[model samples]
Target: MTGANKQRVDVAIVGGGMAGASLALMLAHFCPHLSVALLEQRALPDADASVRLPSFDTRATAIAAGSLQLFSELGLWNQLRDYCAPIERIQVSDRGRPCGMSMRAAQQPRASFAGMLGAVVENAALGPVLHRALAQTQTQVLAPARVNRVRMVADGAQLDWSAGAGCPDTQLQAGLLVVADGADSPLCRGLGIVTERIEYRQRALVTTLGVQRDHRGTAYERFTDAGPMALLPLPRRDGSHRMALVWTCSEEDAAILRELPEHEFIARLQKRFGWRAGRIERAGRVSDYPLSLSLAREQWRRNLVLLGNCAHFLHPVAGQGFNLTLRDCYGLARALAGADLAQNSTVGLELLEAYGRDRRLDQQLTIGFSDRIPPLFASPGLFARGLRQAGLLALALTPPLRAGFVGQAAGFGL
Candidate 1:
């Protein structure tokens, strides 16, 4: 690439999905003087259009209370609230067993926002809101820009990218390069970052359900012999009561579930999930994703850092994957702010190392919580079942233990 096509920035973020967009917004808020560029391989949705990225699909994300606070600080809660359904309570239960626990936001005010434990928002609405906010910031947003090559240079890293097939490639020299290109990241592979993956051999079947009764701002976590299922509240549309469903099961079961007719699927789901959310009236299109625990060997190096699923892809049992990533983004932005990147190298090794150290505990706790919870609940053995019941009983009976679980689930103590 010619010098004319080359540019320099303090930080160049690859992948403009939720992770990258949120990080860009955070940097703009926390380190306003630093130059930042966000690059996405796909074309960004129009201002009035729907987002088509994989991250912003038919699925829904359960934003923890702490994450909501971060977005509110960014001045996004107003717009976000319009698309969100507040989660005032959470109901956890086993399919056949009576022992279970329920958590209410009122009981744990420290881990709540405006009387809400958290809120759920459809990814379609969330993407548009985030991108719309990014338009008001100083960060440069580049879509249809594919980075074909990356090389670690003395200053930091160099990226060669193109707008499309006919366009000439442009070179960008960044003091810090952040990879947020999702799991099994090709960019990470090219950079020699290896990911340790543990496949559960299960798939999460996701869909939206229309219920005959109101969800009443309750999120349900039901454990069954198949696996764990989560039914999170969603904003009602056109006088209909709706909820988002995430049902995890073995691969063989998933294949059978995916091919079943809507009515048959609802019947099976109702039978497996029971009457916790009331009668299921209608169902939307179903999608399934293979489950796994994927952790990148390195989250940060000299002048480079990894973000989002590219860094650590966890099981979605606890709805912690995106929230954890949000925390990571915020932490990195705060570190950059304290370092005053405008006056020094943006990709200083010492600064990056400090940031990683600060984030280690939160990452470990959240990853472990997501990794170990499903199997313990899914086990069929008598001892395992007894243990599950005992744990829930403790949480229900002990205020301190329940509060601790609520705090962690709400994304606080970071």
Candidate 2:
């Protein structure tokens, strides 16, 4: 601890993933007067340009339109535009049903161009982009730093951490603390935060595939007998039509599928995905993630506030986890920038309550979708399937309702 009169940072953000880095950049770039420091444990992100996903990690997140707008406002969507694939239409269906429910761009009131519902990018691509932006900002990046201790007191929040390999720990004091750590956040737990978590006995197998028919910016969400599967289009870089696949199934089935021969796995996927995209020629090495939903009782405590997966972790089936985190990050930045800095820190009860107030409904709505979809979509009985199919028909046949659903998926509903 510095006994000298050293200046304290206005905010110290822990974890430099998309949520942390994006928010840090916003705060530093817009309100540079507010001293902000971003702490990341990795010495550095991988520097190899040839490696897209790197080995062992193969997940991709579906970026929603609202988030894309937020990124656009931050002047980042343009940077990612070429790298991501636009989703022009979404087809939600019950495989056993008679037909599919489609929410198309033409239904919207747009005068020109299909209102892109959203875009999909390799998450591997996202980390590097945000990290690069973070590096460009004046915000201090504590590379290879670990949080050894965190203390929140009446005075302020204190963080003890070690930077560089084999180095002594250093202490930092901040008027506000941001916990942007992932799903299993130690900082939140260390502060005795309560979270509701559900472990579905399923795992999602994700990968990329080359298809015969062009995706034509069409994305498919199919409820299979085994589980739910989504096929999202990716923008072609080399005149090649590419698609990203997310297949959810029982854990045992996922393990078995992962072990199958490459051709065998592709065949299985083809049968489930059908001939809409023609032959499913190739499949990347699969990525597996256990499905779950986690929600922290409170997004803030004392001089501390939680954001991103640290605050709420949703089922990937809904693609709402990262989108929600981005919203939280932007909201936090907005809330901080609007407040009176002389009389209050960004970590005060009033600020926390205000953030909670503005965001609670949105969070709840997304959570409810994640919590509801899996069970309903995963139902085994014929009667349940019949009911779901009927709902799909309703959605497809009803123009106003279909547009509303499409708007939500496109990120325009909010």
Q: What do the candidate models score in CA lDDT, each in turn? A: 0.91, 0.77
* TM-score of each predicted structure versus truth: 0.97, 0.92
Tell me how many clashing residue pairs each candidate has. 0, 0
Instruction: Kindly report which residue stretches of model 2 are placed more than 4 angstroms away from their true locations once superposed.
Output: 3-7, 46-58, 109-114, 237-239, 343-346
Task: Give the per-residue lDDT of model 1 (tens digit) for 367-391.
Answer: 9988998999889999999999999
- lDDT at residue 156 of model 1 (Cα atoms): 88
- Give the range of the ten consecutive residues with the poorest summed lDDT in model 1: 49-58
Clashes of 1: 0
Tell me the deviation in Å of residue 149 in model 1.
Answer: 0.3
Give the residue spans of candidate 1 off by over 4 A: 48-57
For residue 189, what is the lDDT in candidate 2? 83
Candidate 1, position 162, lDDT:
93
